[model samples]
Target: MQRPWVVATLFCLNAAAAGASPANLLPVAQKLPITPDNFCLGAQNVLKTAKQVLTDELAVLCTGNTATTLFKNLIAAPYAGTGTPALTQVFAPRADNNARTSEIMVAFAMRIPKTAVNTLLVEEKHAIVPYDSEAQPPPLGNQLANMKMSFQFMEPPKNEGDADTTFALQQTVDTRSVAVNFKDVSNHELRQYILHPDNFDFFMAGRTLVAPTEQFKKSVVVRGFMTDPADATKTLVVTVAHFLMNSRDQHEQLVLAFSNFLTTDVSKLYQEQIKP
Candidate 1:
């Protein structure tokens, strides 16, 4: 016969467990099995139906490569003056992978060359990448400067019985031209980390974004996975919801217009390095 208080506690615990949603009870990050199916499922949960604002998805096939190598290469790639629009600076406060949490700062330009824009439509299957042929150059208009982004990666709590890790990213975009008023944005992503055969998987759930104005907020889930499609070849799949949050409607529209060009230019930069 249990004491009265003990009986009440047990009843409450059982009730809570029965009422909890799957999203509220994520699996332990360290215990998750490393596999593509699991990775994809994790990615899908990043943004639940109730909180999603905008999303998109892209799948790129590498002729021959494994997911493990692809993950390593992506994180190891030089952060500065690389990729499309060019990353000017990347700094990490905690460099070790074993650390419980890390902070990173990334600076990049947000301009796309005309040459890159022309090639985007021809190569990409997804329609989310936006393009504008008549866009003006920097100083005249259309160029965002000093896009400084900061990211914080936090692992699950060691003693709290928590089971999720997260990444928080914040950035402010200032354009060269005053006519364009784009506000800063913050992305907070809850994700699971899994070690795959030759790669790693970061499956996200519940990504919330707060626009500069604070009043306009949006939630999205993003899935990013990299693996080898075949021997010596690597592939990556990135998916996001169709909705997006922004400071203003115009800002969202402008970003969509140039999304394609920016993505293409960045991809080209990476391809150039891997070309034999």
Candidate 2:
């Protein structure tokens, strides 16, 4: 059983509509051997619904890409199905504080060719490449000085037919910006550039994420085998879910259920590579 307050707080955080009870908010665990027919389109529906919930609870912003804009500007559009997308947010902890906060959420399905995920990940790593921005500042507002990126892997579904996979990502950019230094540029030049552009530079690698153990260390993984009754073609169903939060308290839970499912020890590999 879930804690009553947990349910209530989540509802309040999500800005659930009237009559949305606890039962309505929890994610139903999906079972494996699910056919294309069992691959309910409703999961997308639930993700779509989060738009208003997140917008109301947090201040959001976007830059660099259109797909990202669409994902973060989720208020106006329906849940989109596409490549890995990210969301950003700027936050001020106190009225008088000069520092800012940055949060990121990333969502994408684990499909596409083997090279696709690798290629995309490399491209994404450069999106926020480090550069000296001490001379400039963010165009939106004052810099909070301190910034960190929050990453999450939302639930991703697998195809029960042929072998196909994809990944979805949502990123939250905290309002804060990290200070960057250039070895080639003079301090004077760096200062001038930052003051003019209001841009800072920083470097980041795609590090695995480490979720709190007490809470659900959610996995975007699926495990189960089933033969399609219609064709007798062997089918394997794998479902995985990912969530983002600065603190464990903010994390959400995803449940998975399947028939004749065989559990595997993927956590050891997951812990080593997935958590940052």
Candidate 3:
């Protein structure tokens, strides 16, 4: 079921409102394929629905993002679709223990079913991809970070799975700031990995897990796929991420990197794999 809480962060990006929509003005998602055709998921569900993965120990300041602001500001003007995606980044300084909240709400156009798309996501991600989305087809061993689930690399997804199901992603991330040395680094702990799948919608959320020092590592990712109203034949794959970066100065670089990761990289691989 595409519950109100499914696309927790993405539900707020749409503009069309049914007559029953409340006038309160937080962000209200319009009727779309993934969303119930005639009703709203309600503003209360936007930006605040809590999940078990975001545990109590996560940093208070580190956990928050600019979802409300972006949602509110986007609707200030008319929105036809999830147009160019709204984004914002803010850093909580010493008072809040130096946490930077960087987030983005973007969408990709695809000609595929939500289930197919999501399955590809989990499948492609779970395999090895030394670099991009396309993992060399069969010799998967070579690209698999030496078969490590939690490594100091953004290579590709890997997991310890069984015949029917897979477990959480015990993966590490590159946390060193560009402000620091220019080499690649992955000194952080494992990340929070969650994949909430529905037959008609695609929504997955994950982040870096807390470290041995009990430091905050809950950087969140929220994504879903919905039908494009403008072109019913196509789907609108939306991604909303709230990452805790090292510094606010890394905003530009982060944006560029995320943009590539958000659309170009995965989309290209998706298209290529579907060919006969």
Tell me each candidate's TM-score.
0.37, 0.19, 0.39
For model 2, what is the alpha-carbon lDDT of residue 253?
A: 11
lDDT of 2 at 161: 22
Measure candidate 3: CA RMSD: 12.7
Write the residue-wise lDDT of candidate 2 on 64-120 in tens digits. 111133222332321122322222222221111122211223221112121211212
Error of 2 at 181 (Å): 17
Candidate 2 residue spans exceeding 4 A from truth: 1-124, 131-135, 138-142, 146-208, 211-276
lDDT of 1 by residue, 34-143 (tens): 44445544433432322333233211111122223333344344232353343221232222234222222222221122121121212212212222323434431234
Each candidate's root-mean-square deviation in Å? 17.7, 21.4, 12.7
**Distance from true location, Cα of 216 in model 2, Å:** 16
Tens digit per residue, CA lDDT, model 3, 1-276: 233352342232222112122224233334234432211132113224433243221222123321233332322332223333233332321212244534443422233432323333443243332343133233221221221123333332333220112223333333333242222323322222222221223233333333322222334443333344444334443333444444344554444444444443344435443443
Which pairs of residues collide in model 3? 191-209, 192-207
Q: Assess candidate 1 and give its TM-score to the true structure.
A: 0.37
- The whole-model lDDT of each prediction reads 0.32, 0.23, 0.32
What is the Cα-based TM-score of model 2?
A: 0.19
